[model samples]
Target: MVSFLSCATQTHSLKPRAIITSALPYANGEIHLGHVASTYLPADVTTRFLKMNGVEAYYVCASDDFGTPILIQAEKEKKTPQEYVAHWNKRDYDDFTAFDICFDFFYRTSSPENIQFVRYVFEKLKQNGHIYETEIIQFYCKNDQKFLPDRYVVGVCPYCKAVDQYSDLCEKCGRVPEEIENPKCAICGQPPTKEKTTHYFFRLKNFGDQLTKWLEENEHLQKDVKKYVQNWISSGLIDWDITRDITWGVPIPGDESKVFYGWFDNHLAYISTVMKFLGDKGIDGREFWNSADIYHFIGKDIVYHHYLFLPAMRLGINQEYKLPDYIPTRGHLTLQSKKISKSRNWYIGLRDFLSHYPADYLRYYLVSINPYSQDDLNFDWDDFATRINSELIANVGNLVNRALGFTKKTFGTIPEPDDLDEKDKDAEMKIKTLLSEMTPLMEQNHLDRALKKVMEFSIYFNQYFQHKEPWKKGPGTNSCVYLSVNAVHAIALALSPFLPQSAQKIWVQLGMPGKTTDHPWSAISEIAIQPGHVLGEIAPIFVRVEDADIKARKEELGTK
Candidate 1:
């Protein structure tokens, strides 16, 4: 067995190298804030933090372009699935980039390379006898001439005997609809016939023991998530259907009669996409795909599929395919305190939002108020405006602008503050303590609190500035000026991760050169901004949102 923690570097003390993946965005439609909250933004923060902390991390994601859903959507729109995916893929990529998501590889499921890789795994499982052909009776609507998937069929429930329950499964009884005595197609109200068809099933029950052991050792999974999965495994992991009667997915290796199940095939997409990118770059990508510390970022809804069957498939392959290191699941995002639904047109577009607010502002607000552990976070225009105006603009933005503005105006340069007097000494101590606490908080993924610390430090600096009254007291000698510059530099370093663009703005304005991002986080306290440095013009770090601007966006979102 390949130990996950075997790789170690002399300089890096941490065990294991990591490859992070956000849940692949479906190649169906435009992504909304809910999509960003669930996978993109949170995953980006994790990757950014890890890279900032000196971890060797690669972020991978792709478009889930294959599936009946995509086909169905394409038929409705009178366009080919390729055409559909192409349009949305471009749109989604643009949105993610605009939001500053740093994905190492934005992959697609439709690539021929992905097809080859997926087929290779299928052959491996078949050779191992982990796949079996089975004929099962499933509902078929003759009028539509299409076999109804679990979700597509609907009829009267058998257990509770509720009317119009799903034909494949009854939600009321929570039992398979094949057990239902009598059923009718909800779409046509026609009695459906049970037909036998040949299909393949994954040997999920074979890995029950292995899965149980994996869960037992990895106690980092949240209690609720673990319990839900454990309950499913305890009930039994039946041989999952691995072949679908569809033309939309990867065809079964040598079997012209079947195609690999869309869901099962999609899971292999992450690795395949990586291969495609690496193959394009003329590099062998197998080194990373077969073995790397891969972390999957997903929502709770897909936990079961990812945790059990997905890894089980890999482990069954009897190779060095990497298992997910961590699954950082997040809850849903609500817009205007209500669920964002397409029918209601409540979803806000990223392009529209970016037109008015800066990317950093959105990143700052999302990270600051994220329900990281659990629970839904609400996004209201009023709250967004307030947080930006009061916190970013009034506190973080105001303090940076004022300090630099004062230095530029009074001294014709950025000044560092001198050694603190009694009161000043106490404030400096408090700021240092806050920084000390923030490092670990960020390490633990307590981003909300880390953001709060940023705000707290901002408030502290404001109070310190007001008390010192550098503008009124005249340029505080050379030492005093040096001390002030040092303080501002430390604050800029702290805010870099959350407000990277704005932090870079301050980084340049303070007359500091080089890429702001290359600086080590640990050096935040060193205060590198030198005294006697000629400062650039102090532009508005963050502009206050007016009520009219907020109202216009709110109305636009309402009609979206």
Candidate 2:
């Protein structure tokens, strides 16, 4: 198979390569807007931006198919775990595709490739003395007739004292406790009795010094996140119990009664899925993965697993796959300033949202508001409509429609400009300057800022068009139309990564060949649309989000 290094050498210049991943969505549930806000949307935007900038980037994610939650839901539905996960996997992908979250390969953690890799990694860790077996007191759900692992047990977090926290991780504090306080069987809602069970544990505590060093050195990691993670290390790391008494997970090697923990196998899908994709193309997946910049985009909830467990596993296996270079974690999305709870019917599913509005509207609003931090974002319906109506439809949509619609009506084609005046020169310079400023913002993962900068570009052109009044048909009218049309072109390019569907519509109206992403991002700096270029059929790219529509959505959520 062709290796990445050899391929880079043959090209005479190595292109920037990246393997981007979002946290695997659980197979147990429908993906809600809350899920998209923090992880998938950001990862998709970053991957699209990198590709637009001529980087070789692949976005891979999988269904987290092997958790107790999946088994519980499957049993409730009277279906096998595989059958249940299969249904949600397809459903999740459909929802993601509708929202334009472009994952290159959306596989499953239960896939044969992943199962094999999980076993392989387990064997390697065992041989390297990073794994050991020990008997521990586990909660036995006698009423449910099973050992309560992970989601099957619930209690207050030992570290943060948050009630109703999962045994594995605390949602309120984002920390994993060695043991939860006041544990009860989630299935029976009764306190569970302790029973001795033999389980395998990974030497996660052994990698404390190494993990600390890596976290310190990796400048791309979020400082706020690192501060807490380092504190977790300083307090002392605990050995991770990697095996569970579950039948739905990856079967332990030569042990049919037990399986590898869900967290143990799920993140390994990141490597296995890449291998599956590239191996089909006759490429060395391992070499490519190790050589490229690895990014694991996640939400604040799973911080403990991705930050510690993921890297520790790779380290135990002698770094066969390199550690993540960047783990861009963002905070949760609240609905109308309240925590979105599915059981409460306060969550908007991706499919449900798409039925109400275009995908780009959601994409644009989320990226515009979500900063590159662990700060929680609220998806207020009023705020959503206001941004879409005032900013997206009014500022950006107005600019494109006026520029192209006016050009189509008056000129029917781009008009050649006369000698440049101070106003005309100043307008052109802003596009170039914004492109320069935006490069670093996107590169550094400040996507919210990058999108806001794009909006600022649109606002400037809107004001410039209003000031120039190309409708007056005066001396500078041709120059105004020329620069305005070109500005629309630049706007389309800038919006490609953020609002792809709208950007594509803008491209179609501009009579540009292929998709907006088909062009290099740098083309935004150029006056590419030549004089006399025939414009496509003129139309407004977006409709104003009506207030009545937002009110109806609020009513559905039982909000006044």
Candidate 3:
């Protein structure tokens, strides 16, 4: 079994520290469901699970504040880049918190610490013969009178032939083209002219052999993602242009006219932010980072950056920082069978979703549908309501309410189980077995599968409750109540990582003293709730997701 325990055990062979990071949300816009589905939520869940299992895991993220998109948006809004990013940074963190993404330190890429670190890394790479300056012809907009960088220029992807892609990244094919084809100024909507300028480049091609060896040796990375990464390596690596003609980014050490590219500085924030947090506590962040297990959670769209640019930079700097041990990559979330486009108003904002529904409802539904792979997942309103109503409310919620509600009304406390009957013994054994089955799945980052296993356990107990018919006051009534309530306790622990708020509600409903996460994950396997333990207030943990509300939401999106 590929259990988290097993992974932890191996890491514990050295130390039990872990650092989890989600892809930084660009500070130019509000976070939408698509943003969380593939990265933030999964990272949060994994971090929570690791903490529950006694791992010293810290989840950190920063707002990507130095991209061309931010600069353009700031200019259009008539606000300085700092003021613009400040507003969205707070706003994005608030939205993420609303969705229960518990980031330990939410910093920004534009912070002084990151700027200094970026410059430090640049100097180190320069000394190590990995940084060089070269003159190249860059797109310069005649109308805008500025050199276009990244989001400022739009063109067809040279490799994939996808139209209207950013010059730096092609979202359609997830490749970073060496140069875009038929480039135009995004601001003026006219073909851009070329101008020669000297810019700094990272010797990404130099680390090709090292990266291939790392990709082949790191078994923790997804096989599917590794396959493509290896293929990209085989196709001849290209040196990355590390400097951009922008004023809002980390300044190149001696050159104030140009700054480090957003990708160059943004990812280094991962290290700078964590080090800032640890430095305040008198901890050696470098020692800790090098020793801990690291995970970088990202969507498939940025695979080229995370897989190539990120590791290669670390390797170039004499491995001052270690590369991520696991990159949990997932596919984009499409809405209603179409691409979710912010410009088209075809997306659901995280805050907007929470206004109409509980966070756990969204959390549960997203994780239940999302698999541990790059295969795209669709979020249809009809499908969302069906899963919440039939699966969450009907299956898991039904079992919890039925079990706890009956126990509160009839016994006013947990009843002593009668001597173990065959069925009772089987149910008890199943709870233990389910935890064993789920451990490896969670460890393997198969959160979708692990959550489904928990739901299936709920189904099994619901059936067991139906078969025993505790309402009939039969001879097995006390035993059924006893086992069922214990099952609710187990379910809450199992569900804690996915549906945390709902799990806490279950913990309170069961009259448990502390948070569900306060108990070790292994406690789920035991019948920890004893007889004579008075039940807390018994109320339904989840309300059925109404079709009318869902319909209104769909209509708001201009869908029929």
Model-by-model lDDT, in order? 0.73, 0.89, 0.90
For model 3, the superposed segments whose C-alpha errors exceed 4 Å read 1-15, 558-560
Clashing pairs in 2: none
Ranking by lDDT: 3, 2, 1
How well is each residue in 1-560 modelled by candidate 2, as lDDT tens digits?
Answer: 11111111111122478899999999988999999999999998988877777667889889999978888788899999999999999999999988988888889999999999999999999999999999999999888888999988899998879999889889988888799999999888999999999999999999999999999999889999999999999999999998899888999997879999989999999999999988987989999999988999999989999999999999999999999999999998998899889888889888888999999999988998899999999998899999999999999999999999999999988999988799999998987787787878888889999888888998999999999998999889999999999999998988888888889899999999987877777787778999989988878899888889998998889431
Please state the error at residue 176 of candidate 1 in Å.
11
lDDT of 3 at 281: 72
Model 1 misplaced regions, further than 4 Å: 1-16, 154-193, 279-284, 289-291, 426-436, 474-484
Candidate number achieving the greatest lDDT relative to the actual structure = 3
> Can you list the residue pairs that collide in candidate 3?
2-440, 3-440, 4-443
lDDT of 2: 0.89
Reference-based lDDT, residue 527, model 2: 89
* Per-residue C-alpha lDDT of model 1 across residues 1-560, encoded as one tens digit per residue: 01112122212333334577888888988777888877788777766656655665667778888766787889999999889998888888888888888778787878787788888898899889898888888778898787765445666675567876654445443343334456666456677887988888889889988888788777556666777677777977667887777677788877866677766877788778766766776866777665555678887656767888788998889755767766777777789988787767888877777878899988888888785565668888899989989888998778777777777777897555565577666655654575566777765557788878878877877877776676556543444455555666777777776667888898888877764556666656564566567877788877788999988887787674
Query: What number of backbone clashes does candidate 2 have, counting pairs of residues 3 or more apart or in separate chains?
Result: 0
Clashes per candidate (backbone, < 3 Å): 13, 0, 3
Q: How well does candidate 1 match the true structure, expressed as C-alpha RMSD?
A: 4.6
